[model samples]
Target: MAGCGANVTLDPVTIPTPLIDPMPMSVAVRIPAEFEDYVHEDEVLGREKWRIDLGRSNAALFSQLFNFMFDEVTILGPDDDASTLAIDALIEPSIDAFEFSVPSQSRTESYAVWIRYRLKVYDSAGDMYANWPLSAYGKSEKFGLTGDEPLKRAAILAMRDAAALMIMNLDKSTAISALKDRPAIAVASAQPAADEPAPREKRSQLPKRREVALPPPGPAAGPAVLSMDPDSDATRERVPEGSSND
Candidate 1:
């Protein structure tokens, strides 16, 4: 008898920075009221430490994303509106109107963030903007990596993906079908005129599907008849009747 087995090992995961513009953006975060004191390490104790850590992680993610976008493009803010603007206004603390899930692995954790934001465009009163929800989850069995570096890198990567998705979602040009100038093609609703009958195509009515009875088989060609002379000298005959020709 022989035994065979495979040694399973997971390769350590190395998260890479997301590819996106490094421009900064004037974006603000609306953390959950429940997370207020959670950000304070002294105020946090025991298992609550995990909760505070999560809060800090989220805040950092938002800050980094905003900075990156700002570096690339100018982000408009509520202050841009003269009527509703405050020169030294502070971003209000609104409810975490968006729902998300954070699932962590030994080497990698999944991060998802959804923000119910209000984007004010030029001259137009803005509507509620729910940035596209994002999700990332994976694992790594890498060796010789620094502590927590892998996790941080993974978080950044996830955040980058999230940002790209949000931008794409907001871009109207990408959605040609929904563009204002291009409405859905119209389908005619009027009934066809009765005087103009539909064209009739000549169909060779599938040769009446009747059972074709074949004509009774003709008599087969009669076998050829052959004749021979028994008295011919050329033909030798056996002794006749009772007479023996000695």
Candidate 2:
């Protein structure tokens, strides 16, 4: 074979897949004196009732969802360290809440609490792209045998339920984002000062959001026309001008 100035073609090499990033979360609690509204007589005293700080207890449960991330949970006080996860909560006025239904009876009335929370999850760049607003009713019996224990228990469970709901959706966001391909270029690495604590501004503040109005209610049905009148008249008549009678 004669030697020629020929260039060899090189095929492109395939890159290995990127690793999945773990989901991150933070829980913020807002406890107020009004929490006592749901407590029963028995819960008013003793060590058990003391443990039932609904806001804090609920925050603890929510913290577990992101416990896998070390030193990530931030328990903020009226003035405390901001959390990496950046969840905020506000306590609203008490509303008509429902406690667990009686085991044997179907109907029961319980006190309900309304809590509004804002959760902001940021990407590696510390920019928040996912924001969630969570609000729900927490119910506890007004007066029960277990006393304050039931109230405390109810608050914890209710808070857990609300957090679980929010977490489910957030987990999906992470999974979906992970499956996407990474950016082609490398972003600049931002190292914190050796002695300074991690940044906590994004999580502490809420970004303005546009208002979304709910769909309007469906058209109202014509006043239900009675098939027959109370006097046994088959003819139908509009009742009292504003009402309908058949």
Q: Name the top lDDT candidate.
A: 2
Model 1 stretches with alpha carbons more than 4 Å out = 1-52, 67-83, 86-131, 146-149, 167-169, 172-246
- TM-score of each prediction: 0.30, 0.36
Q: Write the per-residue lDDT of candidate 1 for residues 112-148, one digit (tens) a residue.
A: 2222322211111122112222232212222444444
lDDT tens digits, residue span 1-246, model 2? 332111211111111111223333333322223432232211111211222233323333333433322223333333332333334221111212222222122234442233444444444333333444544433445465354443343334344344444434444532223312231121112224578543433334322111111110011122321111111222211112211111
Q: lDDT value for candidate 2?
A: 0.30
| Top TM-score prediction, candidate number | 2
For each candidate, what is the lDDT?
A: 0.25, 0.30
Model 2 is weakest, by summed lDDT over 10 consecutive residues, at: 211-220
Clashing pairs in 2: 43-148, 97-112
* TM-score of model 2 vs. true structure: 0.36
